[model samples]
Target: MSTRNPGSLIARIGASLIVLGSASAFADEVVKIGHAAPLTGANAEWGKDTENGARLAVEEINAKGLVIGGQKVTLELDAQDDASDPRQGTQIAQKLVDDKVVAVVGHMNSGTTIPASKIYSDAGIVEISPSATNPIYTQQGFKTAYRVVATDAQQGPALADYAKKTLGAKSVAIVDDATAYGQGLANEFEKQAKVLGLTVLSHDATNDKAVDFRSILTKVKGEHPDIIMYGGMDATGGPFAKQARQLAIGARVLGGDGLCADSLAKLAGEAADNVVCSIAGMPLEKMPDGPAFEQRYEARFHQHVQLNAPFAYDAVYIIVDAMKRARSVKAADILASMPGADFVGVLGRTQFDAHGDLKQGAISLYDYKGGKQTLLTVVKM
Candidate 1:
């Protein structure tokens, strides 16, 4: 010790300090947030967009560093593919629960989201859907079930009103994919259409997997309604519209948020020009940070924003905001604090109603012009 060199001693002390610092850094708690969607099916693009939105939020939070309960923490997204199947959605929900995720941000379709919601509710984990618009999703009275978008209750009527007022349609024929989402939306539209004094020529049921619509179009052609309302996702709605055009139905196609997507142009080709659809939230261009967010999203993902990416992005931030307010990373605490969430994100002021639905929702009406989505107007609900 007496013969020890000062430089060597200093180097030894520095190495010890480095080791301690490393240990301290490693002590950060790891929190898991589950994201479930159809990553390998017809709606894969939409699902991937949702995941990318949540992922971007998580990455940004990590970059800035996160501290909860006076302890540093790192967030991780545990994403799973439900394949757009209700059965698969339940399985994925249970798996996420088993994995102990503090919260979940998906189940893209209302068909999947409705069934998977029970699992999250039972496990006391928050299930926030970015795109599921079926009214039943929030009507189930599950405290954990929440959606950032407007429900079919409002969206369906808005579409019907547009058909009656804007399109001046006196008669309409309805078709649904028979799934919870498709059938539910069709039902709501029919109810409102009847009230609006628009004659319902006929309401038909189709499967979500059906590709050919000649049979249905042929039947609807016989009825010769002014407008054909399709209640289904774009994957099916696009083809339905295309086949209707091929059959010379001449009726303009109308659909809900599921039928509203940028890819609809490619899917339906020239038929997209005749399609009018409604989104469950405000138009992207009208969002508070829509332009900047769109640029950042394109740069990060190297693609255009589909539907619901902004909602998903805001959803992740909403969850993180809860975590910060609660000062804890526990699922129960986060869920407890969600009722009071008033985070102003890309979608603007986000506060939930008593039923876990957006307090003040807005529906955006759009139509395709020259293979591009063009906004018509925004209706506040």
Candidate 2:
């Protein structure tokens, strides 16, 4: 050993130190976040918008460099297509769980969100729906379920009130797509309409895929109600309104957030002017950081926000906020931290009540004029 060169031993030790430093510099953890929506069906526009929002957040966070638990972290998005089907939604939920995502933001429709919720609940993964407004979603005793938007319980009454007070409706007729969301919203609207002293003429059930609403419109026209409320998404609501106009139905069409989309004007054409709808949250233009968010989103995705982008964008930030507060990226840790979330992001202050619903939600009313969605008013709850 004495005969060996001391210089050689020093050189080997120095080389090992350099290697250790390099490894330390490159030590970064990759965290995955899951997003589910109907990326391939008629609702693909909305689904893709949701995905883009989450993806934007992930990209921005990575660029800024995130450190959690004293280690660098890179967020990855695991987006899946539910095709707006309940069964497909459950399958997607399970896949996200298997992928070990820390949090999930998605399932655009109530039908999918309700069934897929159990899967996320059993897996203990936090699911924050950006748009599913059914009250039953939070009624389930699953601590894992949460939503960012107002529920039909509030939205239905708001629309009904507007009809009675603003539109001065004495009688109303209702039509629903018969899906969970459609029927649920219609039920709430009917209950509130009764409370508001409005006469209910008739309530009709139509399939969500129904394009020809002449039969329903013919019957509704005979009722001569002042306003017609439709409980469904814009895809069907547009045609319903158009058909009502084609039949010269005198009543204006009313709908909830499901029908309050920018594409509605294009879908219904000239008939869109007869549509009045409510959104589950504040208008994007009125959000705290809405303008900036929309600008950034358009820059990144080259498309306008369809419906749930701002909510989805805020959802990712909320998940990360939980991670930072927990000082860990583990799913359980994030889940534990979600209850106390009060982060202010794109949609303004974010806080949840005992049932994991937004404590102070706001609803925006809109009407289409000349194929443009114009805001009427915002109701704070």
Candidate 3:
């Protein structure tokens, strides 16, 4: 064999040095966990809430000091902004990898979380998504991507039951924003509606930034469905409400947790009222520990509580618990240790399976009656 070129040998050594440098950099730092999400944008509210909850958890965990081996390493919080874009989420994941964070908890939207999971998996980083409810998250066979809340599978079925039993809907039309979460929930709703003895009359799809729903609402109105179940975020559902009213479609509109954000109150105005939906977490008003969280959030950020805020808080705790058990903050170690962890948290008991799916969590249905999210029912599966 010919002798290797001098430049080639230098390149190989440089690459190896870079890798070792990165490892050394991480070893010198305290335990760092990342919170990556759209911290600023239309969906920024969701990201902000998720971040706040995670920050609170990290603070509390470090305060008490998690015993790992013979040392008590203080937890650190590092945040990245994904801007609610899947591509940005991927970049953020890479950034976290470079930082060598022990775990990642963030990117509230499922569309971003789904693709980012691949990055986390490739980097051997454990990711616990607080609010990503897409079924494919776990179905992909990646043990690193974990969710703290129930998936569209449970929420769709629960909402279908509430529509049939509570709304007394004889016929229902389904619509979604064409996102992974939206489309998944819409499809699941159609399936659950059929099983719940409600006739699914029509189906429609919308874009995330679409302002008009006249065409689809018009077609759905023609179907004469008693209800329109919207499997999209409040950003779209708010506009859909106005469009549905304009179309003279008197059907009561229903959406999933994405529509339960407090922003809906201002987005849809009066049209948002009487809209029913199922949310992933108990209302801040319902949980006994909620008021305290709300107060703390208000004090820190000078803002009201965020939807699913408590869920994110609990997600960080679950990760910390795993880290303590694994006696290391490394992602693969935390991932392997997460399964079978019993963590009582802000929402409820938070546990995990080998696939990184939460074992015990409850989904609640909430109605924006008047101007507030009122807890309607709770479902645990």
Task: Please estimate how well model 1 matches the true structure, expressed as its whole-model Cα lDDT.
Answer: 0.93
Residue 304 CA error for candidate 2 (Å)? Answer: 1.3
lDDT-better candidate, 1 vs 3: 1
**Per-prediction TM-score to the true structure, in the order listed:** 0.94, 0.95, 0.88
lDDT of 1 at 186: 91
Residue pairs whose backbone atoms clash in candidate 2:
none
> Regarding TM-score, does 1 or 3 come out ahead?
1
Q: Please, what are the lDDT tens digits per residue for candidate 1 over residues 357-376?
A: 99989999999999899999
lDDT of every model, 2 decimals: 0.93, 0.93, 0.82
User: What shift in Å separates residue 193 of candidate 2 from its native position after superposition?
Assistant: 0.4
Cα displacement (angstroms), candidate 2, residue 243, comes to: 0.6
The runs of at least 3 residues in candidate 1 whose Cα sits more than 4 Å from the true structure, single-residue gaps closed, are: 1-26
Model 2 scores worst on lDDT over the 10 consecutive residues at 38-47
Q: Candidates 2 and 3: which is better by lDDT?
A: 2
User: Number of the top candidate by TM-score?
Assistant: 2
* Candidate 3 Cα deviation (angstroms), residue 128: 0.4
Candidate 1 lDDT for residue 152:
91
Give lDDT tens digits, candidate 2, residues 142-172: 9998899999999999999999999999999
User: Residue 176 of candidate 3: its Cα lDDT?
Assistant: 92
